[model samples]
Target chain A: MEKKRNMQSKELICTACPIGCRLTVFQDEKSENWFRVEGNSCKRGINYAIAEMTDPRRILTSTVKVTNSHYKRLPVRTREAIPKHLIFSCMNEINRIEVITPVRMGDILIDNIASSGIPLIASRNLE
Target chain B: MLNYELVVIGGGPAGLAAAIEARKNGVQNILVLERDLELGGILQQCIHNGFGLHIFKEELTGPEYAQRFINELLEMDIEYKTDTMVLDISEIKTITAVNKQDGLIQISANAIILAMGCRERTRGAIRIPGTRPAGVFTAGTAQRFINIEGYMVGRRIVILGSGDIGLIMARRLTLEGAKVLAVAELMPYSSGLTRNIVQCLHDYDIPLLLSHTVTDIRGKDRVTGVTISKVDQNLKPIPGSEKEYQCDTLLLSVGLIPENELSLQANIKLDPRTGGPIVNESMETSVEGIFACGNVVHVHDLVDYVTEEAQKAGAGAADYIFEEITEKIPAVPIVPQEGVNYIIPQNIRIDNLNGFLDLMLRVTSVYRNAKICVRADEKTIKEVKRPHLSPGEMERVRLNSNIMKTIRPKTISLYIDGEKTQYAI
Candidate 1:
């Protein structure tokens, strides 16, 4: 006895780890995106698919500005994720942008960065 | 030609312990070589606490935990060489080294142990297609900046991978007045420890985005922003649900790979599953007189385990030198069963096996509840029920040598029940 395929399909291999997930990607027309997915055991696998197929992004780790603080620079993270293609632009803006003193962790360092609507704040606070 | 009775590669927790144990076991001539100027490996910069609790019975910062061993080895009159990089090690028990002061030196050893730790998987390793920006950093590197260098890396930061390091860094950045925004993890469940999630993210009100990841890194001279989205099970990006975060810095805490170049050059048999040397119950490698432990053997969450393994390597080396390993080596093959990823100590021959034989493992998937069993030739040798199991968390089980001897079967299988998957029958 053989189990028939649910509407013939192809397997999309994911490189989440060495354990590549042979996933079955089926388009669900409701959302109009790569709709239904299976064969991925981890959440990262599915997210890896959507990002790879359409657009991708990364969580940026860098510095922020401080206002007259003892420490000139402070570590920071973005309030939201940036566009996959615009990662360099965001970093370039950060490199050029410097603030003066009084920055704390979670403080808004840059608001509406490149109009992407993601805020960059200090990942760590400085005196 | 430099020579010694025992030559330990790496000065980390594992290497140091092996050196000390070897000395204690009457190995007079011993030497340790470290690539970094500092003897401690990743521990020196890990400033975060919660280390050494298992080994020392009290919580200590990574540096402090390393200090205890560093100070002990220092007092033991052990010989150590820092800033010495081992280029290669020969199967005949010879090691080549180059230092800033000493150009090249070949050292022969009676016994050698590979204790080199692991390295973090970088963005390049993950192959995130895009422009190479200035603001990208591994989470550990970023940690060194805020804690040691005392410099700001970026104003806006987006963390990829909700591992313990990333989660802790998210909270650290948030505390330092930076906007963490959220932690995006591709996996539905966080790969970090439960405590880290609760303390670092949940307590700080930082959101943990499960089933999400950063699809791209934007910016040229630096980072400008990034695009992220939820993924389907097939792990393909979905359109229309895409969202963007305008941030400068991208931090990756993807994963760690065991550093094992010396082992490879030594022609040591490597466990592909662990990317480390495969050792027997005595922690001896394929090479008669060589041994390996710690992250070099297999990455461990607790330093206590590293010390424990180092002691085994040390003791095994001592036994080999004293010609005590004489009994018939009851070899057992480790078979990774359903829903199980890999198991350390691929083989075991427990003659003087004492206490509990701790076997480290990784699960294939997330299981709400599972029971781990060690089966040998249709006989259950050991079993331990776990409340929950995830691939992110490494599992350790204990079995007495006395019990292991009962199933003198050649092959031993570790499998999980109660969680059904395609991989699991």
Candidate 2:
């Protein structure tokens, strides 16, 4: 068996707290999981690193055009974090839609947007 | 004239929290007057997350955190007025307000809580020398355009002053496909939180130039570019270090000043440092029965702390409404000596002794391996070690009623101990 010559390592800053410890995640050649994290002050950093390496997510916030309301636009957000890859596409879909008046806070604008199983909910009331 | 037990001016997060607490504390007839179309104030435009960490123990977006309080306030059947603007507030607890439906309404309230939040300082306040340009917007104005109005302010941006709003906007404008050239801060260290510096700037490869100032702005109609230069120790521009960046928009996040014109009209003594009404341990200003809290008291780093402070003000207002003149408790003034910037509740009232009171303060500068020393009448009452302290973060110290009882009505000072003065060369 030939030995592996290179292992990839990535550096990230943990956004868990104000300390913002610089975290480094490296691919372990011998381990099956292929990832080991270091330089984190707490367990949250390790979890954040592993998730970042495997799959990343972000809470999307944007505005939707509204008609028949005092305000011209309505603020909306993903009820839960969605996959990072779908952010722009989700924004595109959200940009294409226009909501009517009498919207309440927490009203779902789109169900399972971008097939992410997260609904885009209204962030404020526009009556 | 309409009479109520309490009238809260401004229905932002602070006003909502204060009204809810006051209603819960037996002030049945309470009204919250909000000038906006809805209850939530600036939180509506702040679409990003990282709020409500301390109060809810979970990361929430601005609107979500605000809705939690709004739901609670509504569920309790508390009265509130949206789209109402308070014109004048008299020292005798009289409030005059106006709206479309309730035109020129007057109310004689037993107590009043001023929860009017802060406003962002504009370019005119800082006097950034430039031609009248359309692309120059405050960071919050840009945020409102992109986050709430669904309109992009510009394609290219340069943010001045690395406050939390500026840092967040750097990431927000980037996510919206705008090119952010750099963020210039006048101070040697950023006033924004450290986590924001990492996620907002470093993660996005945006440069944060500390000890930098925007010397001149270039543009006639829309912003064409800006000239930024390094500042000397005295914060004056260093001529040789000037550099230019081509950008369409220039965003200013210089500072926030408490909206206190109504407070001044009420003749409430203002704190020169905080730009807010000065209050004692009860959150009551020099004017009796009138309480103040939230950003109107002083700019806060977190909204949760605003809610907490509002609750204290709410409770204090309710106590004044319910209790009679049984006794007068002598209070002592809290003097900020070395390292302490300013302390809220400028005086510690010793009467109606609560179990504990929290003293909120901010340091003048950054320090390492330091302990905060609290003294009363020239005697050390308490000492607490803080591993790291910065001007950007607020420091809170809890004073037990027992410890406060031991001290007499004299001078109380808070200073830093064991502060490292110099770095090894």
Candidate 3:
């Protein structure tokens, strides 16, 4: 079908402003690394478009089981954005761990979780 | 009755910040009473980052933001009682509170700060046309369940409002393996921050349905489906534009109302617009010694603003106690005119003000290339040009002493000037 040969393009909304300008991205025919970004109003949008096309990352936030604490769950997060594909695998390793009571904020619970080299740290104190 | 210099109700961000500031201002014998078992209040359940961007100058999670203040309060040796519910506050600063450990207790204070924060609007408030089901939950309640209790609400969901809580929850649920059908918003535009829309929904490939409302729910015991319809300009559902989606959970992120039950009992004059106590530049309520801030004063979009506003109330209480405020000046009302929804500090005590005062307000609707004007004595005093304005985002204008000195009018009015421009996006 003609649809199968259609060049792949993606639409993204610029996160820089509340205006949220919709952007369209196309891979340049000349080079695989070159991208033609359209519909961005500012430099931040162009940067967002390029990064999204290349390496997209998201901050992972979730809760882990807590033992012998006032609360049953302790909130945890990656110190920085981890590779998007490793989120579920990271959750697998995170679920196996049980944090003890008297944990302070920024306490690294797991070092390089799921081989992403990003530390999963406690976001709150469980005293 | 136990007597103290100051008694702060609610040990959340506002109360804690107020208590700490008051302590630093030489006001001793302060007690912070909190109804929750923990001191941080709702911040404990909000596990998302993006808080403290303005205060700490770095992005921190909700709990991390509260912990920073909690750590500071700990070193100060400030007196606080958790699991203590304040029942009533009398005109004479008599606080009637009860706690399991202390039983029935009455505390008389020289000054009091009300920072009870706010509560989420539930399905009952909006009267969604549906049978009472097990799956209906407020976005905040669901957030507390998932983030605090580590319990997944449902496998499939249809969120009713695009509030920040709802938007954040959409991503949270999606990441946890639940399918979010769509985030239906009654308003045409999102009430949440722009970053939330991009990160929470756009990143997750979740659809945001604007100018849409849930017309019907088709489940008896548990939510099985929801019928959504495009809304008219009046916000009424269009009859023929209904579309149905199959989902198991229904989350409501409608809105929030400032918790002011004690304010009512104390007979503090409330501004009908803010749904909180009427306050002046000093954050002092009509009742001389009573002060209010944070959501107890008006709903704020950012916790950073809450901390800043509460510090004003804290300093106001300290000024009242330390005799720094010699006279209570007659206040000049700041009236909201065209394009302006409402403004905080409903009244301004120009004579009592030192340095500058912040006049925070929101617009009634979206505007572009609009100029916000402040007028007094039938003359324009101060004007600031804004590229765009929306109801979701609050705009703040600073009123310096020099401007106040120029205006001797009994009332200062704020309104929009210039032509309305189209939204670029």
Q: Output the number of the TM-score-best candidate.
A: 3
Please provide, for model 2 over A9-91, each residue's C-alpha lDDT reduced to its tens digit, 9 standing for 90 to 100: 88777766655566778888676567887888888998887887788888887778988876777878898889877887898
Model 3, residue pairs in steric clash: none
Candidates in order: C-alpha RMSD to true structure: 13.0, 3.8, 2.7
- What iRMS does model 2 reach? 7.7
What is the per-residue lDDT of model 1 for residues B1-425, given as tens digits with 9 covering 90 to 100?
Answer: 98898999999989999989988998888999999876767776665556776678764556656767887898999999999999999999999999988899999998898888998999988887667879899999988787656666787888999888898789767655678877888876677766566546654567778878888888888988888889788777677777889888989999888898888887889988888998887788887788898988876767778888898898888777777774356567787899889987888775556667878888888775579998887888677887567777678888777776655677888998866433210
B255-345 per-residue lDDT for model 2 (tens digits):
9999999999899999998999998887888888899999999999999999999999998889889973222566688888899999998
Better of 1 and 2 by TM-score: 2
Interface RMSD (Å), each candidate?
12.5, 7.7, 5.1
- In candidate 1 chain B, what residue range of length 10 has the lowest lDDT sum? B416-425
TM for candidate 1 is 0.75
Clashing pairs in 2: none
Between prediction 2 and prediction 3, which has the larger lDDT?
Answer: 3
Q: How much is B361 displaced in model 2, in angstroms?
A: 1.1
Cα lDDT of model 2 overall?
0.86
Best by DockQ: 3
